[model samples]
Target: MPPFLDREEIAPRQQNPKGYAQWLFTQVMLRVNVPRSMRDSFVLEGSELRVGEDRFDLRLFKRIFLVSIGKASVPMAEHAIQTLGDALPLTGVVVGLGTWAAPPGILSLRGDHPVPGRNSFVAAHELLQLMQTADEDTLVLYLISGGASAMAEAPLDASISSEDLSAFYRRLLHSGLAIGKTNVLRKHFSAIKGGRLALAAGAATRCTVLISDVPPGRLDIVGSGPSLADTSTVEEVRRILAETPLLAPVPEAMARFLEQMPETPKTLPEGRLPSTSLSLLSSDSLIEEAIQLVSTAGYRVIVDNTCDDWDYSDAAKYLVERAREESVASIPLCILSAGEVTVSIKGQAGLGGRNQQWALRVAQLIDGQSNFVAMSVGSDGIDGNSPAAGAVVDGSTWQRALRAGMNPQNALESFNAYPLFEALGDTVDPGPSGNNIRDLRVIFVNKQP
Candidate 1:
């Protein structure tokens, strides 16, 4: 939204690349920072709260507190406070990547992204203190979005140090395990995840407003479901770890830590208070919005398969082949896809994320062709460890890389696509759009000009 991309510089030769990229960026902006989803899901009237059909009377509680985490935390929390009219006896903390002005009585805590840090540790303690103060007569409202799992953390046991946790966290991220498995593991050791946060509220009435970035039907995994039920068990965590190829050898501390972890409840323990109100503000709806926008742009839109578990190379190859097959379209062909990909970064220290890697691979596959352009983007406006949201490349991209003194094959092999894309001026950076909904990709095969 803040001009992270030089639109004209990245446009393809014979296609309306600038306009399409702009529209996609607008869609990402709506999904991440805009409050339309929040407004539609949360309706406040006096002391009563309505989330879809569910309702809660906040007047029933003597004290009201808020806990917000993840990329969308600030915007969502601000919306809640504004809707609550700033006089609801609210006090709370928001932990997120970007800095934001906190409403009165709320403390804004800076949180690390993609990995938890000392700030996350401190924020976890503060959150515990806040929830520990709540009584049966109190109401705790939690606003959760993607990245909360890393943005806030506290070990359930004393065996693992913060440094150990950080190491393990990095390993899990690089392991190429799907997010659901990653979250299942995250909940096992953390004091605040997998409904532990809700348990800490004692008998307080709890409500949750969720902006889901997890796979569909898994709201319990969103923000690792701090206040919801966790259906995954420790066995699942161990199995996933054993099966997934980790980026580094498992640390001894992690092994010991996992062995010592108490068995996570596969369901709520008897008599535990579930969230009294839960609302989902965003999810696949963003994908649908993107589809409509692309179709409206006059390209013949083709909905591609969800690529959540696909390897970046495999997904890129498949989409490229399909785009090639559709090259005869009278109108331009736009292939759309949504879902995250896994990249096993086994010590490669790449400067790019999965989206860039995927696009880079596609660029290689279509190198000599002149009509195809492919892009993959993280909806949150940041991809992996790189500054770019993603990358876009046309058939000429490989040659462009060569002209810029970059070797595309070497970049892909080293898991270092970011620098190559950067040199070729193909990287797309949309600067922290404050939202997350997995990844979205678009492949355009122009009408054979």
Candidate 2:
């Protein structure tokens, strides 16, 4: 397996508490391999494909259409193709934020992320065209992951330009709304979201293989559930727009579109929806691996997800206090939390993602306190607009930043945590892990002597 965290990159700053924390993080990341997860979750025998407890016979289908989207699209599609080799003729599209040299029968397409652009429109159009080719005898295999909301999007209103769609996504990102709520809005505005993708492939046998990046029990929110039914309604969208002033006063054309928007399909369209859906990995998968590694390292592991979607500062305060209270002289403790936090940008935002922002806040709270380290990292290896995956900080981080002529408070307020962490060599740079299972956080409380 390739090392996700570089020991050399972090060696200069590793010392005592920071060294142990960085070492633990590096160990955990090295084990959280995406291709390994894919391999373990899928197995093929003869003409039968086994995904977890489910099985699909390749011989039963005439043509197999593979639609892979999101950050992990390329890897997931490649693995699926390898697993189903010679069983069926596969033709499909791989839409992703990054580029990949697709196999012979697959079309590799790039799409805009964080916001939709002209490329997103083109990709979505291609997917629609491909879906139209499916019929009663066709089998559609959807390898869906996170980031697909923007990576493949088509406006519900034909009058809405690509620029307006981009603006809509920008508002959603900065609106401080939770991902579920954000996707609710996205589902209503798009043509292929909220089960519309499945709806287009009339009578086809659909199977969805997911790498969930949303919280558990809300798998549909992953990639706005393009192949699954939606439970959210137009009424909820309007209410969200009304309450979230950040998203209010939308463009006139956009406002009109939402006002007249129809609700996403609440029930699956018969014969067109998924016959079987398998979730290959999730936030729990990462957290479970971290728990085992931490336990083996002799620290007592505690899984806490109470602040899954809380604001960055609030989550930092809660997790820090929890770690302090749980710490004891007899045994060290590792508090592991998964899922994402919300960040409402203040103004013209600087370069940082929610994970780095949260890590910075924890740094402030733990300043001068010995033996405590806090880390927040994205599983996909790309955090927001910054290049770093996330960040790691211990008790000494605050003082070190100040000594380095860096202002942590100013950086946090400006959403500029990347530069501060980078200057201190505390940023975790993993560079697109070909995976997305949400964010993972660790609060390590070393035993007091």
Candidate 3:
């Protein structure tokens, strides 16, 4: 069992499919051990530091700096300090969702997420100031994870107000664009994104350790590639802005700002770029662990990520149909998918997220069926504007909602899934898990009589 899950809360449903699915989720999450992964990936022996196959002699550098950002910032920073503090002179900054009691040599600051605010600007300013301090003799270590884009941001143009920056993010969140495209626009708009952060480090020898939340092989998209080279172009940003109707709500100042905005750095000179980088954890790790847990429990597991960037309703239909076709009456089956799904908020979005919305859609489709349960959840333990991580739904969920005088159709349409799930006691609420890879969806089919 994962340390984060509440066993007592899940005890009552132990005999049901929902309980089994929740248990599997907890087990899979337990495998996302950030500290252990960091320890395994980074090693310090004598004055030499080994990161994977690369080695760096710490004695060559005049000073070492560490920058930790995103949801996993606290744990990642904590381990780095514990491991490297005694051996090297370390000073750094951490920007995350909440306040933390930072170590003696570190500065801890909080920033807003899912949107940028004044605090985000402050954090960005501090990070930029620190990065500017590094020179040829400095070695900078960056610990980046999901949510960093919103946690620390500064508009590339100084004239862009914080309100306009927040509006840009808010529009992007509801735009239904894929994560990659969303970040492309973000990189163009920010001074700290793309390869600009590396540029700020000057000629420092930099190393980055990432906990990736983007799709497979898109490591650069994680935290908008603050230290890595950017592959996207300004033309791509223009195309996205022109094509996305959801971005219509963006402030007019944003348009004016973009018109004069210079392209983000596409290539960094020698020494300005990271010397080595490692993806310490990702959705692949989460899915791999989930497959093992289900297989060990005697279920035939099928893995598919085809629905990754699809709209919530569309993904629900595709996965549910696939589950029905693949399920066998003689043996239990579990279908797993890991990656985020897109949601286009039409008007005022109610209190829910893509995970809850998708699960609710699946509930409607499987309504009169038996022995089927579908669970969708975010690894971070918070889903969109809702307090729940996501939600779980079985074949009977529709009828249960109806008996309680709730309209599933109305709830899904208005993006108000949290209240519906909460009323049914099916919302997956684990609080913040202090980790993020991406979202996970599980479809379980029990053996038929």
lDDT score, candidate 3? 0.87
Worst 10 residues of 2 by lDDT: 5-14
Model 1 reaches what TM-score against the true structure?
0.92
- Pairs that collide in candidate 3 are none
Q: Rank the candidates by TM-score, best first.
A: 3, 2, 1
lDDT (Cα, tens digit) per residue for candidate 1, span 118-204: 999999999999988878777788889899999999888876788888888988888888888889989988889989888787788
In candidate 1, where is summed lDDT lowest over 10 consecutive residues?
4-13
Residue-level error in angstroms, candidate 2, position 164: 0.8
In order, the Cα lDDT scores of the candidates are 0.78, 0.86, 0.87
Please report the TM-score between candidate 2 and the true structure. Answer: 0.95
How would the candidate models be sorted by lDDT, starting from the highest?
3, 2, 1
Kindly list the per-residue Cα lDDT of model 3 for residues 82-151, writing each as its tens digit.
Answer: 8785776788989998889997889899988989988889999999999999888888989999999999
Off by over 4 Å in 2: 1-15, 270-274
User: In model 1, how many backbone clashes occur?
Assistant: 0
- lDDT score at residue 70, model 3, on the 0-100 scale: 97
| Candidate with the greatest lDDT versus the true structure | 3
- Check candidate 2 and list the clashing pairs: none
Which parts of model 3 have CA positions greater than 4 angstroms off?
A: 1-14, 272-274
Instruction: TM-score for candidate 3, please give it.
Output: 0.96
